[model samples]
Target: MLEKLRKLANILYWAATAVLIALPIAALGYLLAETPNPNRASALFPHIDIIASPTGLAFWSAFSAGALSFLLFIGFLWSLRGLFDFYRKGQILTLHAAGAILRLGKWLIALALVRFMTLPTQTLLLTSNNPDGHRQLAISISDHEVGFLLAAGLLTLIGWAMNEAVRISDENKAFV
Candidate 1:
């Protein structure tokens, strides 16, 4: 069972590494293919003459939000690699594993926070160009964010327990 899990961890580690390599390339592709429309309505302004301009505030806002999200996802994958490495070594009860879990949880929390912030930001950026003044300031908690937070909490607790178990096991070893 441990060997199987170790194999799985190894597979996941390589998969994440591959994604880390691919993510930037994909984002660059999206940016290059992005076409800005100038005639779009604007709530922030009567008319945004720079819609056709890639350097415009509207363009940058969308681009920046997207890049921020992509970077956060990359952070998650990077953090996960640390945790998975231990699983691959069958050292799940080690301090390193616990630390990796903590790091991974932090990234999960950060990702959720980014998701929370991005919604309103994207709404404002996209609708700032709306001339109808009907721009939405949308904000809501989605199931995905909730799930991420829950997973983070569970992993943290598991890591803590693993650490305790390892400490007890080490004490037993010393007694022998």
Candidate 2:
């Protein structure tokens, strides 16, 4: 069972590493593409009825938001990769693994926060080209943000428990 887990962890570690490399490339392609992706625009500016085509400041605003969010997600993946590395080495219960998990949770919360702030800003920027009356200030809080917060809280608790377990295990070894 232990060997199986180690092999699985090894596979996952490589998978995460691959994604960690691919994500930035994908984001760069998306940003540099001559034509805006309509589906992507719709997803990003869900509340806006009119999405001004990507041009000038509007394009920069969207680009910055997308890049920043992708960076945060990459950080999250790095943390996850750390945990997988630990598991691959049969160090799942170590402090390092717990710290990695805690960091993962923090990254998730950070990504969520960035997303919250960017949504309104992106909406304003994307629609800035519109006539004065047509401009919008949209605020959206989808289920995704709520879920991220909830998952962060859960991971935090688990990290705390892992710390306690490590401490207790150490004490047991000392007592023996």
Q: In terms of TM-score, which candidate is strongest?
A: 2
Q: List where candidate 1 sits over 4 angstroms from the true fold.
A: 35-55, 167-176
How well is each residue in 1-176 modelled by candidate 1, as lDDT tens digits? 99999999999989888888898888677556754343332322343222322325765675577568778888888888877888999987787887778777777777778878876776667666555656556787879889988897787777677778778888999999
- TM-scores of the models, in the order given: 0.76, 0.82
Candidate 2 structure quality by residue, lDDT tens digits, 29-128:
8667744554356555566655455456675776588679888989899889989999999998888888888788788888888888887887777777
Q: Could you tell me how far off, in angstroms, the CA of residue 169 lies in candidate 1 after the best superposition?
A: 4.1
Clashing residue pairs in all predictions, respectively, total: 6, 0
Candidate 2: residue pairs that collide: none
lDDT of 1 at 154: 80
Give me candidate 1's TM-score against the actual structure. Answer: 0.76
In candidate 1, list every pair of residues with a backbone clash. Answer: 41-129, 41-130, 42-129, 42-130, 42-131, 43-130
